[model samples]
Each structure stands twice: as structure tokens, then as C-alpha cells.
Target: MSYGDEHRYGESARADDELFGGSGQTRTRLPDRAGDPYGGARRGGRSSSRSLVTVVGVVVLLIAAIAFANRGGDGSSSADDRGGEPAGAATAATGKRPVTTKTGGIPSGFTHDAQGAQSAAANYAVALGSTNMFKKDTRHSLLDLLYTPAAATRLRGPMDQAYSAEFLGKVGLDSNGDPPTGSTFVSRVVPVGTTVQQYGDSTAKVAVWYMGLIGMSGERSTDPVTSTWKTWTFTLQWTGGDWKIAADSQQDGPAPVPGDDRAATSDEISKAIDEYGGFTYAR
Candidate 1:
């Protein structure tokens, strides 16, 4: 059992539920300023009370506004869900198409080859960092999809060993890779950005900066939830109608100072992890 075989948690999986709850659909009304025009002139006693209500109303509206904006692109048909604009439309919209016609299964033969490589690099980073890689079946499929044949074969054995049953147990999963009852396993990788250090007709070097979630959800779990910054560099080759990894490596951080925010409880963390879907990173 692999992570992919387990349920995918996150915002992408929340279509059936209202965001932030059904309260999201409720519109908050600020008191009519005209009606309260003279209210501010009231004596100190009522003034404080009125001001407090006004402040609370404003805060509610602010929260509602922010929630609405965040929900805008949450639908299934959004552009990011569909892998960006159509090929010819993308090419036509931006004259920056690649010069080479094809690199991998993705459009590589753009007039702007750099853009294509960057696109491939970003998507590759997402796929490589996905939870799916924890499962044997999905890992093999992903490796074949993203790596050169030789590299895939070479990596499969080692990857299997790395994600062995012991590792799964450490992450709070059973031998079949399922999270324990009432717990959620979180292992998501989100690319923060991407850059290309080198590009050519045959090869490119791309670096992806990402934040990853790697921990178990349970009261006694030692790992607890945490995030780390990493730079994944891929040396890619044009192979079999797509870009394939020749080699890859990772290094820690361009990290930021940790904030003083209190960590969430295990249940809250698990709920949040299940409710927030990942993104297909773009430049």
C-alpha cells in the first residue's frame, strides 16, 4: 500500500463541503453608516458599545472577504487544475514558444525553449515530490513518467528500500500503508518556485524550491507535524518524447526565520492536512 492508494486529503478533495463551513455562503452586513451617522455623537457610555459592535462587524466582513477570494480558484475546472492553457493557445498568447518542437510528453518544441524547460521543471518537481512516491505501484508509475528508463530502473530498488515497511510504521502507517484509525498521514511537497540554471536541446538543469510535510498525526507521535525548505535540482535529458531525469539531488533551505505561532493540536493539524490540496507549481 502506498500513499496514493490512501485517500487524498486537502482542499482539492473538499468539493462536496462548503469552504470554512456553510457560513461562507452567508453575507455579513455592516451597520448602515447613515443610520449611525449621529450615533458617534452619543455619550461615552453608548459610544464604546457602538464602537465595539462596529469593530466586530468589520472583522467579520474582512474574514468573509478573504475566504471568498481564496475560494475563487478552488473549483475543479480552474486553469491550474487543467495544466494551464491549451498548447496552441498558450503559444499564441505568448510569443515566447519554444524553438524545439518537443522535449518530453509536455510541449517542449516551443519558440522560447527556456519557458518550456521551466514549465517541465516545475511540473516535474510537483510530481517528484508528491505523496504518490511513497507507494510502490504509484512510485513506479511516477518514476517511469518522470525519469529516464535507465534511471528509473536504477532508482526503483533503492526507493523501495527507502520507503520500506519500517519507514511506513514510523510514519504511523500500517504495513499496507494506511494511516492508523482516527489519524492522518501527511506527506505533501509544495514547490515554492523554480529556476533554470542551464538549458540546451538535449539537457537542462532546473532547481525547485519547496516546502514539504513529513510527519505522523497522533498524540504520542514523536515526529509531529513540521515543514522544511529544500532545493531539488534535476539534471534532465530530452528522452522518449519527454524530459526525463538524468540525475537529481537535494539541499536544505533558503529558509526563513521560524514564526512564534503556536503549533496546532494533532487533530487540528490532521484536519488541516486533509482539507488542503496541493498545487501544480508554476513560475
Candidate 2:
């Protein structure tokens, strides 16, 4: 399988670990998909793997309302990690409610403060990174539910173009986004943590670092499921009454070193996916 990343969605640039984006335009996104709240690491806006063996977090680009980026990452990473502490060690959740209700099976009715923005961005990451994004109906439903009206409107055309039939086939799905007869496809995002870069009364910028799983999970599968880490940033506005994404972007990952544990079998992975239900993320 071939792996490639592009810069078509007005690509972003990083300087000394600084993360920045173009206007509110979303880059092309077509991967297996999401559930859970936070999962990946922060890096560059590398594209999802283009063919078989693809594994990446959801990459959503916005056209006009993007804000936030990593401001500092200088000094030696080895030196920083020498203490054996976790990243974002200073981040702690507020006792405030992260969610209040669910609309269309997705978390909604978030508070208007920074915590609410964090909660919304985290949940939206799961929705955007899920397999549901591959289907026309569900995709549109998510767009309507997760994004601002104008942003969703601007996204429909490009998003459709990105999740083209050709792209779907490449990811082992049919035109309707279904997998093969005896195979099960898996795509999910689990957020690791979130940070607020810029927050105001009506607009807040939050970033989610998460881990994602995507691919075919079946015995005969040539491309068994794999994992990828990424950082997702969102520019959200307190719309109507809740926080809605105005624009967003993704980066590769500051992935941790792999462990030496043995890999699981296809059946094990598939069964696990089926048995482990997703949670309504509020982190």
C-alpha cells in the first residue's frame, strides 16, 4: 500500500513548532473514521494514508474561521522527557459540566466557557473521525450537527469531492462506504488531552491530541488495522447557544515510541471493536 500526504487545503506551516493555518478551508479527508473523546499527538497536517494500511485521525479543514497553534517547542525534547512526566502535565479538567445533552446521538449542549469549548472540540473530533463521515447521509448530518451553518455549507462540496468514490475504494469501501463481505472495517479516535490557545467571550480555540485506529479487521485482510497519532485544532464560536466549530485543522503527531508488545490477531481486534462500545466523550 502507498502512503502519502498533501498540502491542497491551503496547507499550513510550522516554525519552531508553531502551528498555523490558512483561511477557513478544510483539507481533503478520507480515512476509516471516530469514537471516544481525545486520542492523538500534535505535529504537522500530514494527510491520511491514501491506500490500504491507512491509519490516521480525522483531518477537518475550515475556510475562514481558524485560530490557535503551538507557540513553543524549543530546547531538547530528550531533556524535557528526561523527567519521565507526561505531556500537558499541567492540564486538569474543571469540575464544570462538559456536556448537557445529545443531539442526533452526538454530544451537544455544551457550556459557553473554555471548558465547554474543550468539551465540544473533543466530542466533535470523535464525530468527525468516525466511519460515519464516509457515508453521504451521516456525513451531512454530522456536518450540520458539528459545524457552523456557513462552514458546513462551504464544506459539503469539498468534503464530497474529498471522499470521492475513488478514495472510498482505495480505503476498502464501496460507494456506499461499506466493507467487503466477510470483512469488518474499523476507524476510531481517542483523545489524549486538550488545550486552550485562544479564548474569548464568543470564540475559543482548542487543540486535541489523540490516537486513531483505522483499517480492515478480518482474517483474510491484507491490510490489518493500524494506529496513528495526531493533534486536531478547532476554532469554535458560541453559536445559537452552544459551541460550534468555525474552522479546524490537523497535524501528523509527536507520537510516543512504540512498545514491544505482541500485536493482536484480526479476530481479536474485530471482536474487541464490536464488544467495546464507544463513550460520549466530554474531555
- The digit string of per-residue lDDT tens for model 2 on 1-283 reads 1111221221211221233322112123254455644555644445433421243222323212222222223211111222222233233344456776899999889876666777888888888888897798998999899888987887777777777889888788999999998788988888877766666678766777889888898767877898888878787879899998777777777588999989999888989988998776554
Q: What lDDT score belongs to each candidate, Candidate 1 first?
A: 0.58, 0.68
TM-score of each: 0.59, 0.70
Candidate closest to the true structure, highest lDDT: 2
TM-score, cand. 2 vs. native: 0.70
Q: Clash number for every model?
A: 23, 24
lDDT of 1 by residue, 1-283 (tens): 2221122211121221221111001123564455544564556878889988998998899799767644532111112211222111111112232333432332233222444555566667667556676678887887777777877877777777777898777777776677767766777767665555555677666556677776778877777878878766666678765667766666667677999999889999988877886643333
Q: Model 1, 24: alpha-carbon shift in Å? A: 42
Residue-level error in angstroms, candidate 2, position 259: 0.5
